[model samples]
Target chain A: MVEFNKISGNVWNIPKSGKMLVPATIYASERLMDTIKQDKTLEQARNVACLKGIQKSAYVMPDAHQGYGFPIGGVAAFDPDEGIISPGGVGYDINCSVRLLKTNLSVEEFMKKRHDLIEALFVNVPSGVGRGGKTRVDRNVIMEVLSKGAQWAVEEGFGRKDDYLRTEENGKMSADPHAVSDRAISRGLPQLGSLGAGNHFLEIQKIDQIYDEKIAKAFGLQDKDNVTVMIHCGSRGLGHQVASDYIKEMEDKYGFKDLPDRELINAPINSDLGQRYYRAMGAGANFAFANKQMITHWVREVFEKIYGSVEIDVVYDVCHNIAKMEKHKIDGKLKQVCVHRKGATRSFGPGREEIPDVYRSVGQPVIIPGSMGTASFVLVGTKTAEEITFGSTAHGAGRVSSRSAALQNISGEHVKNELAKKGIEIKATSWKSIAEEAPEVYKDIDEVVRVSHEVGIGNLVVRVVPLSVMKG
Target chain B: MFCYAPINYINLMPQTENMAEKYKFLQHTADAKFQAFGKTLGEAFANAALAMFAVMFDPADVKPKIEREIKTEGKDEKALLYNWLEELLYLLDTEGFLLSRVKKITIKGKVLEAVVAGDLVANGYKTHGDVKAVTYNEMDIKKEKDKVIAQVVVDI
Candidate 1:
């Protein structure tokens, strides 16, 4: 067992363990610790510490949960020269992320037309299971989307051009199609605009609570009516297929017969395994960016169809689970590293060139979505995050129990009815999923976002209560 | 005779009856749902393998004569169990083969080997459930008196 000292109320530090190149850190409240204790999240975090070229420290966010190899809310940085990139670190859902679009409509208008809006959203958005949008892409064009991300969507009239700038990596990574397998390409071709099942959602929400007035104003979320439609999804089935394909192929073919853990299977950052997986993962990420853009367009269309005139603009889109080359100050010198954020988001503070100009003063808006029937938060990045963490924060209220356990405690119908009773409308293809995502199955979002803010990892801006949701 | 679930059913696989008393086949309702039972160490592991495969397909569909071999070594009994099942999951994912039946399961200390057989079904054959990967979570193989029991929570 790795010995860890209680650094703070919610922080634990594991002194370097066996073969671990560095120490490990975990963030969680006493309540959150209960869930962490129930499983091997700490063990997994320590396992991440054992990676070859891991730099600085291996950290787990407050929402950490047990996952394949890395904990769900795990973070680690690897030396660009010596370290390797593992798919488990980034996860199968490649860039599984959250995108928030600001709207001109306010809470009052939304309240007046909530029912119509929710109904329109449910019908318009393609949701549930392998539910795909009507749009289909040919292999060549899909290869384009696989490369271009939101740009492809914009070029295809799915979204506006300005939206790209508001997105991370400008909604596209320089992806090479040849790096991906043919089967992976085939999978991406048919599922270009799709929402895969399990934890993916499209939510309609209003600014129900505001924290930092200045930051909220800067984010254009000051008033009550400022509605936001959050598209929570990622690379979809195509990404899953890609991750699965590579993990299997690398297991036998990578020439590393002795991997510590299969889920932690990886190749050096500059190696063939690393390059191929990154390219394919990037392609899937682009597909996700395009998928969300189209979904945003559909959301805009639904608002137009239902409320006649709705102004929805792209706020900011950021991915939670992804690995990207980033410049972070390490050991007093600035160097490039591959940061793997499994269930965390970038929390770049104040003046990063990557952020849109409008919110430069306040910092990037970090959208922390609450579970169904709970409250989601909007946080602003801070300079403290830059120094302590690798400018990252928690993604959401991580689950405390397994889906089966959730099902045992609550029925899907019961969960739906309960949410409905609270005046929120939820249209789901799988109520069983809703049950699995029951509010009780997760850590409190309020506490999670609060910790992120309190720890100076992220700053609070606004809290939005979901009025309606569509789940796949 | 065994009660077998259809491929086109609500959950991927339904509840099963195991010979071991210490371990029980968990329904789709437990946190670490769906495991195996036995009176000895090997029996529990063998049955756990069977239950995991049945989660993906019907045991009846698995033809036992066609053998698929697997080998694994672990630092301890629990790690061995996890590595063993993880290897099986990899085999299932890559080869398009589901090990619905485990003909034999033998363990010596922390090293073990097994033979399994099953067929792959179409994707989303059971839409109601999507188990991404198996896990070492909540794994426990204990010898309580004359019975041997082990439990694992798979990441579905």
Candidate 2:
């Protein structure tokens, strides 16, 4: 069993041992730590600590939960010279991300046509299992989408040029489409704008509370009156294929002998396979960026069809699952490192060159979408985050119960009815899904956000509650 | 009336009923996990495919209206299982086909070929979930004296 030392309030350390390059640190309150200890999440975090070239410590957020190889809310940075890139660190959904759009319509105005709006959204956004989106493209177009990302969508008339600015990496990453396998491309071709199954969704929300008026105003968020839309999705099939292909390649070429787990199979950052996987993963991430852009366009059209050409500007788009080469202070010197954040969000602090200019003084917007019928928050990055957690924050209200266990305790019909009674409209492909994603199945969003705020990893700006939900 | 009573009544049960279950689904906090059991390696592989599809929809709801053959090669037994299941996912995502049954499977060294039957998604056919891909995480194929079992966790 792993032992912990309470170094400080809300902070614990798993001392470096047995092939560990660094220690493991967890940021959680005593109460939350009790719940976190119930799972193998900390064990996974300890496993990450053993990885080569890991700098500082393996960091786990307060909302951390068990995942395949890495905990859901895990962060670790590796030296570019000697470290390795594990696909599991990025998860299957390459850039599984969330985007928020502020609309001109107020809650009262939107409620007047809520039914019509929900219907239009449900019809426009192809959702659920095995469902394809409206856009169908051939291989050539698929390559373009992978290469140009959201820019391709804008040029193709799917969104505005300014939309990219609000997105991480401006909705485009340096990608090599040729490095991606044809099978991956083929799998993603028909599902361009789809909101895929299992935890993916599109929801309409209204601001319920504002903690920091300055930051909230900077994000263009208003109190109680303004309505917003959030889209939670990812790279879909293409990303999954990239991760699978690379993991297999690493096993075949590098061999998996002595590795703690096959799921952590990785290649040296500078190796040919590693570089190839990075490029391909980036391409898959681009596909996701383009996919969300297309969905945004459809959303705009629906709002326009109902409200007549209303303004809908993207507040921010942040990826929860990904790895990127970044420059950070390590051992009192700035060095390049590959920061892997699986089920974690990048919370770059104030004055970072990467953040959009408007919010540079404050920080990048870190969005955390809650489970269906729960409250989501908008937070800003902190300098402390960059120093402690590799500039990362919690991704979502991490799951506390298994899907099957949830099925036993919650009834889909009942959960749907309860949300409906609370004035939140839900449209799902199947009732079974409602049960699996019941709000109670997740950790408390308020507590998770409180820890994040108190730790200074991310500071809360606005909290929004669901007005309507579109589940896949 | 029935004078031909079997020496062992339990042994006289139908072979299908006497056999171990094809597969059983396990619970992962975020994703689904399963273990497939069979008396032979091929059966274990075939059952693993069923478990993957079962996570998406009830197998009873699907019919063998369409048939397709698949062939894959891996460096080892673990890779072989990974390749086989991934091929099934490829079909689901590319052709919108759901697996009803594995008609046949043949494994030679690291290569595998199989015949799968399913139906085209249409008005009568629908899927209840989407499985993104088969993962190497906690993936293992074990062979015992009387049976073989394959364990896998899929990213949904």
Candidate 3:
């Protein structure tokens, strides 16, 4: 059992006890804390704090829940020179990210063609289990994708060139495809534009609320006057294979007898194997960026086919799971650190050079997607997060129930009918997925967003409600 | 739902015939978990593969139309189980096969060889979930006088 001390409003601290290098902090309210304390989230946070070169306290977001090695909302930063890189820090689906697009069409205009549009999207976006992509690339082309990311998609006419500017890292990472194994490449080649199953979706949403007028305007969001499209997917089979390959390598080279868990397998940051895994991870992340870009192209085409040519610009895209090298202040000195956000997102504040020029003064745009059939939010990063949590923020409403329990508690038909009654059109490959990912299985997203905003890690700009959802 | 009798030479041993009843699912927060049992390690390993695929779709719905041979060696029994399931997952992801049954399996030291049977999910058979990767978290393969049990948690 872990003991917590209330440090401030919406913030609690687990004291640095045992082998911890630093205390673990929990950003949650009393009500949310009850649920947070029920799981091993606190224990995982403590375990993360004990890692080598860990700086500051490990963070547990309000949406924290139990995961294999690290909690879903776990966030930690390690010194690049001395720290270790673990596959658990990045998760299996490397760069499982979200991209939000703003359209000129309003809810009233989209409602007329909602069903047809959803059907088109469901058919166009290859989804479900073991499904291949709509656009198949050869080995040579897939290598380019693994290295170039979204830039490859734009070059292939999948999306516009400017779309990369709105994406994180310009939708490109310094990926070395050669670091990836041939098996991973084989899995990725046939799945370039496909959406894998479980919590991945494509949804059409309408602006429901705008919290800050200026930020919302800068994001091109107008409450009740504009609609948007959100794509949630990842690197598909390729990323999973890369992670699996690396974990085995780490286990084979360095035994895990002393480690707390085998899943927390790692190598020194400067080691050859560590460098190789990082490059492979980058390649996997690139695949995800290109995957989302291709889907964006399909989304644009569907809109064009239904409602002529209209404005559809990308607001911003953020990765939910990744470990990237960044410069942050530690002990009053700027240090290069590898920030591992397993189920968290990078929320860089204003003045960060990585952000685009259009939003440079306002900070990076962070998209926090709620559960299926629930409200999603658009927020901006804050400097406070950089000071407290390594410029990281909560990813989403983390799951609260086991998949088995969820299936037993809710019926797919009931969830479908209930959403339909609320006027939300859902097109899914299987009703079993609907039952497994029912909104009830997730934590309260609104409250999760509230804690995030109240703590100043991420501040809200606009909220959107789903009008149609297409799931794999 | 699918059964493959051993060759006439091994018909004298009946313990492996009904060991399919040994596996059952376990509840995990975000992933799928299962525990498989057997009188011998080979049967336990076979049941573990079945439990892994059972979470993705109903094995009864899959026809044993395709047969594939899998061989992998690990440093130990635990590593062997991890590699074995990973090999099966590779077949499912790369070949689009859904596991229906295991025809035969032999565990010699750290080496595992098995003949798995299933139909192609690409043949229009439906699946309920996707098993992303098999994990070593809480993985256990234990041997006792009467039974051998293997437990695994797979990322979905």
lDDT (Cα) of model 3: 0.86
Q: Tens digits of per-residue lDDT for model 3 on A187-208? A: 8877889888788999999888
| Tens digit of per-residue lDDT, candidate 2, span B1-156 | 001211123123366852647788776777778899776787778878888887777765788888899999888888889899999888877877888888778788878888888886654564555687788777888888857889998887
Q: What's the TM for model 1? A: 0.81
Model 1 interface DockQ: 0.12
| lDDT tens per residue, model 1, A414-434 | 988888898788876655667
Higher-scoring candidate on lDDT, 1 or 3: 3
Docking class of 1: incorrect
For B1-156, candidate 1 gives per-residue lDDT tens digits of: 111222223123345443313234453221345556665666667667766654434555555445677778766677677667766755543444556566666677667777666655333332223444454444577777745677876655
Best by DockQ: 3
How many residue pairs clash in all the candidates, one count each? Answer: 5, 0, 0
DockQ of each: 0.12, 0.51, 0.62
lDDT of model 2, residue A463: 97
In order, the TM-score of chain B in each prediction is 0.72, 0.86, 0.86
Kindly state the number of residue pairs that clash in model 3: 0
Winner by DockQ between candidate 2 and candidate 1? 2
Backbone clash pairs for candidate 2 read none
